[model samples]
Target: MSLIMRPATEADIDRLVDVYFSAFKENPINIRVFPESSPQSRAFWKKNLEGDLKEDYVRFQVMETVDEPKTIAAFAVWNAPQKATNPMPPMPPLSAWPSDGEVDVAAEFFYDIERQHKRFMGPLEGAPEGSQQRPHWYLELIATHRDFQGRGAAGALLRYGEQQADAAGVPCYLDATPDGRPVYTSKGHGFREVESRLYQGGAYEHVFMIRDPRTSA
Candidate 1:
């Protein structure tokens, strides 16, 4: 099916919420990590992203088949040059910590902190060796419906985001959950060990990740 890609609008909020939940339904780390976050982690993310648009820090996008305007198969949330204005827990420590056993503990608390660090000091979040500048844009969220995982839908979304970032002559940044890390890597996103954390719901473990297209080929 051909997808009509466009910037999300207010009318699209509900569907975007559904798409946001559906795409991130299984990713708990993405759900947590926000300071002063709520029990309804999913709800928090939905409201936070949509609500934060006021700060001009958010840019929403959707991929929909021509047949269903109410149904969104994929979505991307981008953050302009601004701080992550949401309630979130403190960032966990890196390497110095141990694992929580074979159950795949959430080893990404430090990841969240790293993201916060980026919020505080863009391009200096984890400050690469001799790194002096921060990327121009950031990706708050990105996902595709499970049914369309392997499709080029995600790349299409990223391309849209890239165009936005490229227009500003800056690189794009983001935090990838566990599953997203590899995907981002394949797309040339570098994976750094930030903080690891245990999400309350399923106790899902997640790692913090960053992506910069500038340094990538």
Candidate 2:
């Protein structure tokens, strides 16, 4: 099987969103946040992906199998340091959402998650201090399509980001789910857990990890 990794473009948004939705549809955090499998959930995710693709500070990449290049096997989204006058823009307005009611419900769920995160992390300390003080690469999302889980596509995408981070002389940061912790801690990435927090009323816990830039020997 031939596999390729490349930067994602606007034309790839739908496939990228599909990969993300399929990978996270059953995730504990996504289930807790979205709750329902509806057009609204799909639309929200699609729009979010679109917005990410349009942002100058964001980078989106996808992995595809050569036999079916149009089908995304995995994807990763990241945020680079932004210029002082060009901070990351806000999410699309409510009117752009698919359904007002669904958006409201999702907003409340996200708020709860944020509140829990803040409570566990403490004010202004959710991320590592070094990352806050310096320009760093932030991994916003990474997922492998369910059918492609065992094939190492996720690791490939992660290493791509690490190479970029190393080239920039900056650390890389990501929030990991329970199932993803092992992968992030494995040899190549050198990620260390900086914080952990339980959510969903104690049903789950998320891990925050960072990989410091490699120093020349």
Candidate 1 structure quality by residue, lDDT tens digits, 23-135: 76555444333222233444544555566455555677788777754467788877655433332223333332222221123344445445564553344456555553454
How does candidate 1 fare on TM-score? 0.62
TM per candidate: 0.62, 0.79
**What's the lDDT for residue 154 in model 2?**
89
For residues 1-217, write the lDDT of model 2, one tens digit per residue. Answer: 6678888888887777677767887876576545445667677777788888888778888888889445789999977755323323344565655563455644544454444433332324454443323456778789888888889888888988898889889778777787888889888789988878775467777777888898767
Q: Could you tell me the lDDT of residue 198 within candidate 2?
A: 70
- lDDT computed for candidate 2: 0.72
Looking at model 2, residue 175 earns an lDDT score of: 76
Which consecutive 10 residues in model 1 have the weakest lDDT in total? 95-104
* Highest-lDDT candidate: 2
